[model samples]
Target: MESFPHSSACDLTAEIGDYQQFPNPGAEHAATERTPKPKLRHVRVVLLSFGLLCVLQGILNVALRLAVREPTDAGGTEQSCPQGWLMFGSSCYYISSQRRSWDASRQDCVQRDADLVVINSTQEQAFLTGFTMAAWVGMTDREEEGTWIWVDGTRVDKDRLQWARGQPDGAFGGEDCGDLRTMIDFIGLNDFMCSARNQWICEKTFW
Candidate 1:
């Protein structure tokens, strides 16, 4: 019943024998499972971890912004006024409890990072009316007689402010410095001597 020659059978058997030492499919699968993963897989894991951290950082930034946001109001938030200062119309006034000559008063204001008050509006005048019966203001005409200017070097718009009736008469040869008078009947602005000692008002405005 044998169809192949004896030599042909022996050659076939030799070829089969050569394959005997080769690993089986199951062994190949086991070896593959035991092998270490590719380095690119580790790099991918690191990248994913970094991406997660970045996302967390972004969330933290958003939380901080929300935490630091302040509520605003219609008239805007009211600013804090320093001690011994009175706030009125976005400004603060420092009224001295003692008296000093106009020049010395202004110097003191300068030392305090402020200047003698410049009355800008009738409302401001009313707010400061009773601070003292009289106080040295920033008005002066030392540079030119009758050409009154504020300490800030701006021309005094005489008409823009109220003057004590018939006052600022340049009385006593020259009343160059100005004062605010709140005495019952004599309440208004008046020109006075620069050397006169009187209470003073310093003003600082905040924007």
Candidate 2:
């Protein structure tokens, strides 16, 4: 006779139940793995952006330096001649075309905040001699002939005085007017009538 089925339907059901208990990955595992990938991508993007910004800033700095231009004397002190007159060394001189008496010439110089020419040194005397062709200077003895004095009240330095040969002998009744005379190989002095029209020289000290 045929033997009955050794395993019953209940036994098959028990086998299926055991299989279900075995380990199996689910939707939660898939989600956890996908989330980390996007986080890493975001970090990489931020790093790249920061590096690009730094590079751009460095380029701009170099370009700006190359494009700028500077003056040769930039940040240096300015230079200019003295005001209202030409400067020769430490002095200022005014050459005037208007003629005046010895006293009037002194007054004119005073009004201009200067003094009639006072030759204190040989260098100055020489420099002024070049300017004298027929100009009335500060030397005169209008107050008392034979005692010439400068408008600034300084006695004429006799050593520096370049009197012409046996000149200033008070020609024409002790002529008190002083004029600068120029001759060949010599710069000299000439006494003139104070009322004669001639240019004048005025000087002022500068510091």
Candidate 3:
């Protein structure tokens, strides 16, 4: 047979060498150029799961709030305190233990989250004065010799005060202190000594 052309033989050898060296170029190139499908799918699944969990938590919170909500009363007001605390209009009252001076009693009330009693109206004053025992009711003349004032710095409303007979008499130099003195008729007065220890009524302003 005639000898083949040199260039053609060289080309045939090069082609055979290339085929042997790289038999699956398409597959290799596809693997290199494309991202890992399994890893991307896993990441997407994790992100979706986290988002769903957050949404569920938010929905649960709203449901709980709705379930536990309290209803408002006819006046659009809600009862603030639980039972046992005496409610007076928009305030709360607590009578502290007996056996403290007027100043000590005021400090005790302050420590207990309240202040000395402040009688606003005649009715309130009358109601408090009717108590059987002579308790402290927040009035005092400690600042001046005879100028009486409430612990909250309110001037005495003469009309509201129901003084017992012969009260504020400055007896035994006792006018400096004010107390709720109950006579046989159960009436009250701003009498008694500042040094005398007695139970005190505390008044706190609430919302």
Best-performing candidate as measured by TM-score: 1
* Per-residue C-alpha lDDT of model 1 across residues 1-207, encoded as one tens digit per residue: 869745755475433334356669998888878874688679989999999999999999999988644444367884656799887776778999999999999999999888998888888888888879899999999888889888878887778777888877999888999999988778889999889899999988774
Instruction: Score every model by TM-score.
Output: 0.62, 0.54, 0.57
Q: Across residues 109-170, which tens digit of lDDT does each residue of candidate 2 receive?
A: 78988877776776776677766466777887877767778777877766677876666777
Best by lDDT: 1
Model 2: weakest 10-residue lDDT segment is: 69-78
Residue-level lDDT for 142 in candidate 1: 88
Task: Give lDDT: candidate 3, residue 132.
Answer: 36
- Which residue pairs clash in candidate 3? none
Candidate 2 regions off by >4 Å?
Answer: 1-84
* Candidate 2 structure lDDT: 0.71
The stretch of ten residues in a row with the least summed lDDT in candidate 1 is 10-19
Per-model lDDT: 0.85, 0.71, 0.72
Whole-model alpha-carbon lDDT for candidate 1: 0.85
lDDT of 3: 0.72
